[model samples]
Target: MSTLSHDERASLADALSRVLARQYGFASGRRQNLAIAPEQLPPIWSTLSELGLHAVMVSPDFGGFGGGADEIQLVQRQFGRSLLVAPWFQVAICAHAVARAGSPTQQGALLPPLSDGRAVMVLADRDAVELDAEPKVTQAHDTARGWRLEGRKTAVLHAGLATHYLVPAVTPNGGTGLFVVDSSAVGIGCHLSRLVDGSWSGDLRFESVDAQPLEGLSLQHHGEVYRSTEALAIAGVTADALGACEAALEMTVQHLRTRKQFGQSLGDYQALRHRVAEMYIELEQVKSACDLAAEAVEGVDSVQPTRGTAQALLVMSQSATWILQQAIQLHGGMGMTDEVAVGHCYRRMLVLNARWGDTREALARLRGDGMTKEMPGVAGS
Candidate 1:
């Protein structure tokens, strides 16, 4: 699908903002803690579905709105502003993957429910890790009954609320395969955990669990998909950081304008002005990086979109940390207080920076790209 014009995107953004204001109130620390309130999800899901946001990622052939990466990013940015905590991202990505890889029957069965928000899905990709080592997935296979799933997945966001999970597992031949597992399937288990942002997470266990192998879907192509997913996630997270930064900056600016120090308004101080100016510069840089990364994934070569995404992720991670720190410092001790929204945004940014892959991981991916020759058909080539 072609990209939406800036004005069209802005109209969607405005509508989303209005809905969020009415439904979620302001972005505050208190609201952050209440992210997954059971009572809030159904309505949120229905609202998004009605807005056609749920169908944005699905292809038109599947009776969806047929949106591409850019449209998805736009919606996610709005979601970030409210710190919206629905299972939409998980469901969208999984739906996209299934549409790309699943059999005709599977697509027909999954797409409609997902497009209408009647069901929720998550990607269970986390794996066990040895001390000081990279995480790896355990095998999940059973020759009997043509079923196999033997592994533990960690940090599965929204797992508790999801009806289905798309798990990436290693086949006996060492190839990766995606499997659709119903949450209610016997032998499947979950341990609920809390994220730094107060979102719901779980340690999922599949002990000889039955899974319908997603035929034709190969793990070999996942590198690009993984990178794209990370890029998309970083884009949304950067939006969250931007929202938090805006809130913090606004609060700080108001205080400076009204609060007097040494018989003068804090805004009149040269030092305070410089700090605010620095924050604005950093925010703009971060915003540009995010937009570029989003565009790169949508239009650039599929062989290595991660290169651009990694760059964006690094900038976003650093900018978020810097903005949060500056905002907190400017707010004094009250910034750390539970009553302050800055503290919550600060915490959320920290969590988002570490999710999918942290800054260190992103840097490694970026540097690793330098060792390889450019592939044919890439934008730069």
Candidate 2:
């Protein structure tokens, strides 16, 4: 199916804004946190599911809305504005991976529940643990009766809430394989932790945990699956960062117009005005980069667009952090307070900076020759 047109996206964004305003009153100076209590999730889940948002990444045949990177990005931006705490990113990315990699039987079993919002799935990739030197899964194997998983997966988002987890593990033969593990199984326990943005993560322990091998699923050929997952995350989180930056910029602009100093509005001062103008310019740059990244992901075949995608993410991360910091400084001490939405947006930007890959990592990947080898036409010398 074709991607949504600009008009469709704008309509969807408007509808989402109405839903968010009615449900959370987010734009009314209300500070929403990332830590969501169990009781707070069901209603929001119902709303998003009813709106066909949760199924955006799944294919149409699998009972989904049949969306691509652009649609997912639009929903994520709205989610960011609302400060939603659901496992949306996890579920969407994992569902895409499964649809691309899993066997027909596996897809039949997993995609419907995910599309309907009856269950959630998380990616159990431990690459983040290497950064923190935390416990991470080192191996996986197949037993006579079933698959056995032995590894420590750390910083799994929404692990406590998901019914199952899609884990990437190194097999004995040294190939990477995907395994599905039931969260309620014996030997599977979640150690919950708080992320810097106040969101929840978990350290998962599996000692010979029973798992079902993803038969017929392979990462071999094209390597598009992994790249697609990363591209989705970059595009999705960039939308979130855009929302936060826009919110902060709007708040700063409003404050400058009303807050008085020297018998005039703060916005009247040349120096402050210049700073606000700079913030606006930077925000626009980031938004443009986000759009470019989304387009690169949408038109993946001929372009070999990984470099452009990484560059977009790098620019977005840096610009977002800069804008938010300037916004905080402009708002004075109130920006540092928890009562302010700008402070929360700042925290969210920091979190998004580290998700998928940080600026340094994205740059390093872009500079490397590995990604360019396959996309020969676009490869940098």
Candidate 3:
């Protein structure tokens, strides 16, 4: 994974901001229906594709910019801020997994479409989104053609729009094997559902669905690949949460400055001002945690990558949730309604917090990994 230079980062951020501003305002986003059919791609998806945003995760070998976690943060943060609804998050996760683990032939076959936005693939992990929730849903059995997958994966992001699904299944040997299944394959059932944030996901039921291993990959190395990919997924969502928190705080401050109480602006009140400042401090903390998490996923930092991401998920989930809640409270009655942006922001944060691994799950992972010692300023009492 290659890190981008400061100049490249700035250039990419500026371009994304300009495009998102013109194409994805709150009003426009509000017009987007929560239920998107599998065959119907959003118009904005084509625009983003034209901008080559999808290429951020693919390697240069496959006609992409060869970006790592840093680039993903830049793109996803903007997605979070505008509450953009698309399958980019799923693409980032899937692309990173393939780039890190797939063989050359596999990369050649998959990477080009992925980077150019021609394909949408999602990871279907039983415990990927929720941690240790229930009985394992899916298992892969070896077949002459390749494999057969039987079970279900629920609440898969952009599953409706996916061309393929990357499923991790339990092999007979008790190790995880990653497989690719076409969304239109026989015996595959996809039931679309709207998420709280107006995005869509699918409940996938695989009944003897034909599948192939993620091409020439060694199962012995699967554990490391899975861990790193999970770390990246956490880091990616944390970046989105950071963006959402920033937007929520900004919306709150704007409301306070304009909305009046007893003919005095709400921002004029000393108590309210202090609360906004606290929110600002929390936002900064989230920013730091987000950066470190990205670095950890990229293996550019001293912190153990997987453990670092788990820690980040915990910290950001708490701070981001608090920031959004404060935003809603500051807005008074209007905040509770979907008519305003803060409510939407809060809902978005809730979804992000729950995804990947929520605060409680992250904490459990940290404790399980023996990371109980509190860092001096990082993990406060």
Candidate 4:
């Protein structure tokens, strides 16, 4: 029996298929890993919004279609297949974090713009210890106007382009909590860099930057909500990896059928055929893991706060790397060159592997629960 209803699956399929149809010029970019700049994402993202693709993570009360296990994993896989350059991946992480932890007022403030794809937010909680979930290194002090934060975050995904940042900090009373800071705050400073996949990340400094407390993010809910956000992030990355693996496999199969070797099509090689079959099996398993993680998040179980996001990511890291490697090796020398989209798929998967959390980091989540869990947004202090 399936956890998702027919309508949920069908709706996502229809929307994503339409998105694939409307998205042209995606494959021909050749050497261009990022097809559009961050600023240029609005028009394309707006089109996705029209298709109701961006509204999947938020509830209908928050100006979204609904939140379930169905759409996000499916859509993210498709995004991976096309090697999408938009900040949709990061944006989805921030959006769902808010959905899980925000107050009604905060949701009212953030979700509509997010659901329609007009706003962007990034989480800035990683500090000296990258995997810590409860941020204690970033200190928040009550100010005359609001709050002032002082700390630094490294490799904040899409920090340069995001208008707002969800920053977790230690309250003066010693409670750990989350706060919302404007990217344009006076004391904030950001030095940006491009990742291998053409997405932007930043090394950020907050020298007493003015911020508003995300008022409703109470202590009782902090750990679970943080774990939930980490799960959503994992789901997005795993979904991407799955999609890229699928594309790489398909691309490899096509290359095998058309390319000639030793007076025979590469597909005629028994060894290579066996490798492809093994890869297909790995891809199906990876896909199943991603789907299950998504379902777990929607189901909201206690023991699995990250909804198996960490487990899914670990599975993806191994499977995606193996599949992409096979794709590259199967394609011969052409795989090493940017002239082929297959190379792009490999690079994108590598980039995803290193970002947020990788296989080792994911394994830490399985090491233990609570503060010991290896998840994004932890304050390993």
Q: Which candidate is the best by lDDT?
A: 3
Pick out the ten consecutive residues of candidate 2 with the lowest summed lDDT. Answer: 372-381
Off by over 4 Å in 1: 2-7, 27-43, 140-144, 216-227, 299-303, 369-381
- Could you give candidate 2's per-residue lDDT for residues 96-194 as a string of tens digits? 878877789999999999998888888876533455443343467778867888867766777778888987666655456667888888988678876
Residue range 1-381, candidate 1, lDDT tens digits: 634567877787788888877876544424545654532353566888877777877877776766666676667666665666677878877887677667888888889888888888888876766686655565646496885898788878888888889877766655556778999999988888667666778888889988886554554554344434445555555666667667677777887898787899989989989999999998887788678677766743364665677777778777767977988888788889867767777777766765555567667767774212111111121
What's the lDDT of the predicted structure labeled candidate 4? 0.72
- Global CA lDDT of candidate 2, please? 0.74
Instruction: Evaluate residue 65 in candidate 2 and report its C-alpha lDDT on the 0 to 100 scale.
Output: 63
lDDT of 4 by residue, 1-381 (tens): 223467877877776766664663455432233555543453456677877766777777877766545556777888888777667666676777777678889989998888888787878767645454453367788888778988877778777678889876767665556777888889988888778766777878889899876556665456556656666677777788888888889899999999997899989989999999999999988888787677667644366745366677778888888889889999989898866878878888878876666677777766754333222333331
381: Cα error in model 2, Å? 24
lDDT against the true structure, per candidate, is: 0.70, 0.74, 0.78, 0.72
Q: Candidate 1: lDDT of 106? A: 89
Candidate 1: pairs in clash: 140-149, 140-150, 142-148
Q: Alpha-carbon error at 331 in model 4, in Å?
A: 0.6
Error of 2 at 313 (Å): 2.1
List of clashing residue pairs for candidate 3: none
The residue-by-residue lDDT of candidate 3 on 115-137, one tens digit each, is 88899888877422246444443
Candidate 4 residues lying further than 4 Å off, grouped into runs, are: 1-5, 28-43, 128-136, 173-175, 299-301, 305-307, 369-381
* Model 3: residues with Cα > 4 Å off, grouped in runs: 34-39, 127-133, 300-303, 369-381
TM-score of each: 0.87, 0.87, 0.92, 0.88
Write down the TM-score for model 4. 0.88
* lDDT: the better of candidates 1 and 2: 2
Candidate 1 has its poorest 10 consecutive residues by lDDT at: 371-380
